[model samples]
Target chain A: MPNNGMGTLLKTPTGISGLDEITNGGFPKGRPVLICGSAGCGKTLFAAQFLVKGITAYDEPGVFMSFEESPSDLTQNFESLGFDFEKLKAEKKLRIDHVRIERSEIEETGEYDLEGIFIRLNYAIDSIGAKRVVLDTIESIFSGMENMTLLRSEIRRLFTWLKEKGVTAIITGERGESSLTRQGLEEYVSDCVILLDFRVIEQIATRRLRIVKYRGSTHGTNEYPFLIDESGISVLPVTSLKLDYKSSTEIISTGLPALDKSFSTGGVYRASSILITGNAGTSKTILAAHFAMSSCKRKESTLFFSFEESPDQLVRNMATIGIDFEQAIQEKMLLIQASRPSLQGLELHLMVLNKLLEELKPRTVIIDPISSLITIGNTNEVRAMLVRLMDTLKKKQVNALFTSLTYDGQSEYNNSTVDAVSSLADTWIDLKNEERNYERVRSLLIVKSRGMAHSNNRHDFIITGKGIQFTTSNKK
Target chain B: MKENTTDVVIIEDKLELTLYISGMSQKSMEAIRNIKWLCDKHLKDAFELEIIDIYKNPKLALEQHIVFSPSLLKKLPLPKRTLVGTLSDTEKVLKSLGITTEK
Candidate 1:
């Protein structure tokens, strides 16, 4: 849907992260957009960020006509997002008009239109030469005014007038039982319609955004998960439908010389995702720590997500295996984020990871025991999130190493995560703990390494104070 | 006519109203004529009315939070009231404006 040539539709870029990428180029330019959502779904914040970003990033003046909150309330609410509304107002780049429609104060009589509103809007727009406008929850007028037919016609005219005035407008509406909006405002704003939804699945709340309709332009139709934080709204356009990521030919270490020697190419490909699956206490975390240490040694930043242990605990535990992460942490080359898998839903975890990736711009990422994350989500959801995470890392050329814990007797083919990740991973290593001669010994085997040659033999290894050491191979 | 003229001055209570309209549109004209007729038949000379066209004074609309054209606001009376559209319903207008037409 790349718009080129003379027939390209003009677009106004909304500076929200990943939003312009999903909307193709933001909402249809100079047309009214309908944002319908249930209560507390971040609709107003989304609109406010758009207005603020339009002024700050694109130099486009904006008008926010609020039907619910007063101007002071809006200004105070948006202050946490780092928006200086008062300064923008003083600079004549922004105008906030609070339209209070109290149901108890008015008596509707004969034929009348909302001409005063139009005139006021015109005055406000002309006063600041605003190019963008927001009518936050304009549907409140329905509860205040008794005339439905007149209100509907006037609202329809408002949209037409906004387009005629060549200003991009966003009109928010509350979700209705039967329609997209309570008053079915989607019918009036046919150019673009975006729906925000907040759902609590298994007691974990997640917010999502979807484009219900975008006329005369193409958009991502999938329901993308969004995040609302102190900074603002960030929509993760996680639709990596095409397998178009560029592959790298450069080789990288396995962090252990014995493991590197086991591979035919000496090491795995750079930016390739590697999976280390093993039973309990089979040294998965130790191997991931080795990868992180090696990445930091090369001056590359690494992001490690430890679902099982705290950061200090992980650092102390890995220290016993001769992998010192303290220096790396001190050097700011390694960031370990430790949290329980059940602390939030799968989407929130992914969003946190995505946000960290954007902020840190790390080159290596390690997820210790991705199996714990599987316990919180269904099989399909975990797989979808894993795919998105892996695809994002691959697109950024970030080296990723994920460790999964398998049951003692479970077959790799029967495990849902193994089945899902084995196909996507560029390299897979299987670790096992076996008892022989009345003693338990550790072994490692190369499952698959795409685009490279590797040993198929199982090699026995031992963990010492120095690191993982190769002992003997039965060559089976 | 004699009773209405006497009723206009007998109360000595001033009724003040302001009509906010858009330009000189037909709705504005109709609202003006309706209110004038209602006042003549009811309050006579006791009421003071001023009409402000919103188009000429758009800032006034924003300042007063006026949403509809031809809106009548009872400014002087305690517990101020607002009525939108042409004042065609005589009884409802009188009651909402706190005027006793029966006397």
Candidate 2:
């Protein structure tokens, strides 16, 4: 949807990370955008970030008119986010005007309008030559005044004046029970509307942002998950909408020489996904560790996400199988990230993985027992999350290997996670344990290998001090 | 020293008032005209008046808690009162300010 030559509406970049990309550029330029949300949903933070980023990133001066908080309080609150309001004001890049209206201080006698606020705002904007403006929760004027008709007309005039001033503005409003804003400010601001929602699903609180309307520009309509950290708000856009990834033809080993010989190409495709499903103690983590070690041996970066074990525990336990993750980590070739599955929701887990993949740029990623994620979400959510994860990894050309656990007597054939991931993965391997002569014997089988012929027979394997060993000879 | 004597006379009357307004808006101008006319007819030579444009002195607006434009503040004579709107209703303004107008 390219807007070529037909007088595409210009947009002012909101410089918030990932927000500009979703809005296709940003809010409609020189127009007022209404952001409405319930209490403590980050509306004020979003507005502040927009103004601060305008000053720092785009070299645009801004004015912040707060109807609720004082200038000193605002400066003190945003100081934690590293926004030096004092410094910005000293440099003449920012101005803050606080409009204090007490209901008990004034009496309505006759025909009055809200011209004082408009005059103050105009003065602040003109004083700094601001290119951006934010009116945080202007609906307080409705509560402070007794004349509804005059206030409404004055509010309407204020919005029109903002547009005529030719400066990009953000107006934050409190969410109402029925309407988008408590005062229905959304009706006055017609250029764009964004809604922020915070909810607790399964006892984990997650913040989501959605663009309700954009008059003339195309935008992402889905609810994008956003995180508030030390750097401020970041919305994670789903990267799976388009399937335009370039597939690689290079082959990479599966760590075991015998396992590599099973495939016709002597290895898996470079950027393909591999899923390993088995019962408990069937050496799934051991196989994943071996794969990670092989990727590290090639001098390529690898990220290992462990859900059931701590990093120290994984390092110590992998040492029993002769896999030296400690050395690889010491050499700066491997990064082991371990987190509890119940700590956050499935989407946050995916976001963390996405964030790690972006920061580390690992050539190979291994998630030890992704089945633990199923406990945090329903079947469909986990499936969708995995699909998205796989798409992101493939688009980044990062080979991924995931392990899943099956219950006793369920077998890898009938498990739910196996059914979900086996089809999505390009290479599927199953490990099983059987009782023979009062001992549990482990075996491996290549269930399905895409674009290549693979061995169909199951090979007996053992986990010893030197990693996994195949009892049979390498045979195609 | 004529200006000083006039100031002394105004202070002797003990009636001080301030009008907060935006610059030259129609409603503000009307309010100013109406208030001056009422002051001349009712309190003649007994009250002192000051006009402030909030656009030029926004900090003063915050200090006085001026929410609406064309607001009149009766600052003197204790028990302060505020009247918001164009001062078109002379009777109500006089009653709120405890000023007895001669009919």
Best by DockQ: 1
- lDDT, candidate 2, A41-124, per-residue tens: 999999999999999989999999999999999999999999899999999999998877656546676788877777777777
Which DockQ-derived CAPRI band holds candidate 2? acceptable
Cα-based TM-score, every candidate:
0.95, 0.90
Docking class of 1: medium
- Give the top-scoring candidate (TM-score): 1
lDDT per residue (tens digit) for residues A1-476 in model 1: 23422356877887677788888778778889889999999899989998999999999999999999999999999998899999999999999999986566677667788898899899999999999999998888888566898889999999999999999999999999999999989998989999999988777788899999988887888888888888899887767345898999998998987788777788999999999999999988888888898899999999999999999999898788788998899999999999999998887798889889999999999999898989887898888888988999998999999999999679876798898798999999999999989999899899999987788888888999977888974332
- lDDT by residue (B42-63, candidate 2, tens digit) is 6777788999999789868756
TM-score of the A chain in candidate 1: the value is: 0.95
Candidate 2: list runs displaced more than 4 Å: A1-7, A239-241, A409-416, A436-439, B1-13, B53-67, B74-82, B89-103
Give the DockQ (2 decimals) of all models.
Answer: 0.78, 0.49
Query: What is candidate 1's local distance difference test score?
Result: 0.87
